[model samples]
Target: MKLLINIVRWVARFLGIFLFLFFVWFAIEIGSPDLDMMSNQEVKLFIGNLIMLMGLIVVWKFEFIGCVLLIGGYIFFSLVNYSFWIGPIFPIFMIIGILHLFCWLADVFRIAKKISFSTRLFLK
Candidate 1:
């Protein structure tokens, strides 16, 4: 179980880093949009991307919060774009978020198990 958890955690970390860098490169290639001229939807999309990017950055130190941000940002972006099927990147990030969520849950359960064992030992 520990090995599995580590594997999942590391995989998610690598994928997140790759996605972050890819987005940065893509943004640089495309250049920045004029926020003053952006429509409401475009602005929303920008915000969603920012949130997702922040999630990718924060996930390095905090799993659960990062997972929430990633998933939430994806949803926000999808809704703002009026479509869920925006190529593969959105789904890939969603999968990464799910992976992080699983890692968080595993850590929580492991800690709970240890605490329970210690409590039982103390009671006896």
Candidate 2:
């Protein structure tokens, strides 16, 4: 169980970083397209990527905030495009959210165990 938890946490982290870099690559590929000419899709792409990047960046120190932002971005895009949410991407987001919650629980349990162990030692 511990190993699975660690794997999930690491995979989520990797995905977050990968997605951030992929967004940068995508933005660069457009090569200074006219902002006024850009469509809603393009605008959403840029904004969503920026938000996700910010969320991922701070996730290291603030897990809940980061995960919520990450999942929220997914939800927002799903609603706007109405494409990914129905497809495989939905499962990916669901996995990430569940993994995040599990990671939080694992940390809390670990901390509680340590505190209990220390208290027991002190009492002895």
Candidate 3:
């Protein structure tokens, strides 16, 4: 189980890295947007994308926080765009966030179990 959890965590990390690079390349190809001329929706989309990217980068150090940022950013983007089914990319990122979440949870539980076991041993 621990091995499986580690595998999932590593997979999530790699996916996050790949997605981050892909987005960077995509943004470079698309060129920068004119902030002054962008509509409110466009601005929101830009911010959402920024948040998602930041999450991906931060996830390397903080899994739980990063997953929250990633999932929240994607949801914000979907809500602002009024299209939850925009494409597979957003959903795939969301899945990656979920995977990170589960890994974090597993680590948390494992730590808690060890602490409790030690406490019980001390008590006995």
Task: Judging by lDDT against the true structure, name the best candidate.
Answer: 1
| Candidate 3 lDDT for residue 52 | 90
Q: lDDT tens string, model 1, 47-73?
A: 999999999988889899999999999
- Off-target runs (Cα >4 Å) in candidate 2 are 32-35, 38-45, 83-94, 116-124
lDDT ranking, best first: 1, 3, 2
| TM-scores vs. true structure, each candidate | 0.95, 0.67, 0.95
Output the TM-score of candidate 3.
0.95
Residue-level lDDT for 55 in candidate 1: 93
For model 3, residues 1-124, the per-residue Cα lDDT tens digits are 8999999999998888888899989989999889999999999999998999999988889889999998999899999999987687877778888999999999999999999999999999
Per candidate, the number of residue pairs that clash is 0, 0, 0
Looking at candidate 3, the ten consecutive residues that score lowest on lDDT are 84-93
lDDT value for model 2: 0.71
- Kindly list the per-residue Cα lDDT of model 2 for residues 1-124, writing each as its tens digit: 6788788889988876676676568779866667688799878865664565677776777887777776677767666666665465344544565567679889889889999999999999
Error of 3 at 116 (Å): 0.5
* lDDT, candidates in the order shown: 0.92, 0.71, 0.91
Against the true structure, candidate 1 reaches a TM-score of 0.95
The superposed Cα distance between candidate 3 and the true structure at residue 103, in angstroms, equals 0.3
